[model samples]
Target: MNKHDFKMGFILLLTLCIMPARAADINAGKSKAAVCAGCHGSAGVSNNPMWPTLAGQSSAYLEKQLKNFKAGLRENSTMSAIAKDLSDADMQNLAAYFASLPGKSAGGDAAFAAKGKEKAAMCMGCHGQELKGNGQFPKLAGQHPDYLAKQLHDFKSGERKSGQMNAISKTLSDDDIKALAEYLGAL
Candidate 1:
């Protein structure tokens, strides 16, 4: 084949390969996330403190978490069950839908902020300086204290497995987790 023709074919193939990453439909995501609204809230804020808010979370982080849940890399019974049935497109769309929504700032007790700040210093490495994480790590600021504590507890107990978080949580006391959660929640 001619060089120009070969280049054109290669470009077409590359575009098709990358299409799935760009095919997320926000409207479809909204529709699909209806089921998710039961726990994660209609607008991505959870009514229950035990459930984590999905709104304003990075799309990449959300997508990674959902994919991990489906793959059994992250262990949560409810999330695993829910994620198992989701197609890649569904997960992508859901991430987009939730990320598009406004996030909530559930304030925590002021008393814990000092201790939490000290404890959170270690978290700044991966979760960002302000805890408003990038695409890989999740945003911790403005999250629910209960949910954050639960996740930290789970990480410590080996229930939820993340290499860095597991090791970090292992050294934290109950008070540390509580303080960190409270501080982050208020941020």
Candidate 2:
């Protein structure tokens, strides 16, 4: 290559190497997230029953889901529409913005938490005190109660396949799922 071309290529490589891997403008995400506010919440958490609370979800995981929605790998009408128009940079920025936000608990009902706490004791070893799941285990704290319940049911019925959760969930009854979902929402 010519000297000028070589120098330009080197500069481009250097810029790509030095740029922050997760640098995304939250402001841009805010604008892009407007439609998402209906389900994911203006802040990324959701009050919607079927929709999952995206707050505190792993950025990598959220990015994957967003792409999944767009690709039709995940089935959600609203979410798929939202994802369809997103560019890679838009998805990245959205992930960064949501990941950077603080996670909020919906504040569990005292009665449900009291009952769920008992159930939570059984879960604490892996799920932690606040039910905020660690690596690979999705955070249960403040997750949508309906979504959690559906997952539990899916696990029980083999609708959802997870070698990890399938075994653990086989033991959970419908009642257990209800209690756990209630408790998790409170956290």
Candidate 3:
């Protein structure tokens, strides 16, 4: 290459190296999240337990779910429509925005927590020992109890289909599900 071309190439490479692989613009995300405020609240914490609080969730996990909803891998009628038009960058930005917000905490039953601890052992393999997930696995700690119960129900009923989750959840009773939710939500 010519000297000028070599210089430009080196500069480009240096710039790329310094840039994050999925650089999200938080300002842009705030603007893009306007529509989400209805269900997810202005700060990404949904008042309705059924809707789930996205605040303080791992960015990678949030991004993956958005993509999955768009792709129809995870079927949610409302989420699918909302996510349909989101670009990869938009999803990344939204994820980052939500992840930047604060999370919530819930109360737990001591009796249920004891029972749920045994059940939660299975989740540790993927969700980490503390239930603070990494990458694609969601952080279950401090989530909504009703949301967790509904998700377990959905997994069991095939409304939300995951081969592993379906298999694991199908065996759980209503009490087990409730206990698990109570335990995890309290953390």
Q: Which candidate ranks first by TM-score, i.e. highest?
A: 1
> How many pairs collide in each candidate, listed in order?
0, 1, 0
Q: How much is the lDDT of residue 100 in candidate 3?
A: 90
Which of the numbered candidates is closest to the native, going by highest lDDT? 1
Error of 2 at 53 (Å): 2.5
Instruction: Tell me the tens digit of each residue's lDDT in model 1 across 33-141.
Output: 9888899998999989999999999889999999999999988899999999999999999999888898998788889866898888898988899898777799999
Q: Is candidate 1 or candidate 3 better by TM-score?
A: 1
lDDT of 2 by residue, 1-187 (tens): 9999999999999999999775778788767777878877888888777777777866666777788889987666777888898998899778767776778776555665667667777666766666676544567888767788898888787766666677778888787788788888877
Off by over 4 Å in 2: 1-22, 118-129, 135-137
What TM-scores do the predictions have? 0.88, 0.74, 0.85
* Candidate 3 clash figure, as a count: 0
lDDT score, candidate 2: 0.76
Q: Kindly give the stretch of ten consecutive residues in candidate 3 with the minimal lDDT sum.
A: 105-114
Cα lDDT of candidate 1 equals 0.91
lDDT of each: 0.91, 0.76, 0.89
Model 3: how far residue 28 lies from native, Å: 1.3
